[model samples]
Target: MFVIVGLGNPGKQYAGTRHNVGFDVIDYLSEKHNIPVNKVKFKGLIGEGFISNKKVLLVKPQTYMNLSGHSVLEIQNFYKLNPEQLIVIYDDIDVDLGKLRIRSKGSAGTHNGMRSIIYEIQSDQFPRVRIGIGKPQKGDLSNHVLSRFGKEDQEEMAITIGNAASAIETVVTEGVNAAMNKFNG
Candidate 1:
């Protein structure tokens, strides 16, 4: 089984914010795959189901962004899964808005969530899907990530989230290379 983790802060206040795009993608995947992510496990909201014949655990960590690793590590250890069997999805301010960058393994860069996962898991050799939110034009970075999108950007983000869900499906059904070829344009 593959463990798919989407990083974001929990609670209603964080919903629809740029930092919550990971959660949005998880929500999209849950709805599309008929998986209800209502179970609390591994310090996250999880739904167990199949994606193209492959058993999967869709997770939304409730430990907030910076401490996401705690939830992820629990699931990893419980399942005895290798890093390769894990797929992490989160937002990236460095990439252009509504875009995606898929990697099989890499550094966390500026994302504290990714950093925490890498630190707790003791490796960076895991697949990851990064949704672009773009950098702040001005003001504090935290404010920018916590802010909601404008009307125009919301439409674009909707498409992006759908694409992100599709990308993850491809990753599960095919492989990281195939997903990268299809969605990493």
Candidate 2:
């Protein structure tokens, strides 16, 4: 079994924001697979189905973005799964818009949600597919992340989120190395 977690704040206001890119990506994946996120479990809204012939649990942390680790740890503990079996999808501020980065393992950089997950889980050994939302040109980062994307960013965000979804699917079926080679480069 493999677990895929998408981090984001819960609420209508944060729906299409850059920080919710992870949620969007997982939504796309779930929609494509016809898996509805109907169950509230493990501190998250879970959609269960098979991705690439592997049992997959698509988790959208309802605990919101910053406290994402609470939901993740619950799922992690319940499944007795290792860190390597987890794939986290989240937004990145460094990479260019419309770009996707598939990493085997790395520090959270500036993402508070990921930082919290790392702090709670006590490891950064999990695979992650980062959907780039780009850096802010003005205003605070928190504002930028919480705010919706501009017209220019909308198209790019759509494309990047789709790519991120595919990259995660690749990880589910092919293992971290294959996903890294196919998506990272």
The C-alpha local distance difference test score for the whole of candidate 1 amounts to 0.95
Residue 149 of model 1, lDDT score: 97
67-168: candidate 1 lDDT, tens digit per residue:
999999999899999999999999999999999999999999999999999999999999999999999999999999999999989999999999999999
lDDT by residue (tens digit), candidate 2, 1-185? 88999989898989998889888988998899988887999988999998867899999999988899999989888999899989999988887777888888999998889998998888999999988787888989898778888897788777777778888888888787887888775
* Candidate 1: clashing pairs of residues: none
Best by TM-score: 1
Instruction: Give residue 84's error in model 1 in angstroms.
Output: 0.7
Evaluate model 2: give its TM-score. 0.96
Any runs in candidate 2 off by more than 4 Å, and if so which? Answer: none
TM-score, candidate 1, is 0.99
Quality of model 2 by C-alpha lDDT: 0.87
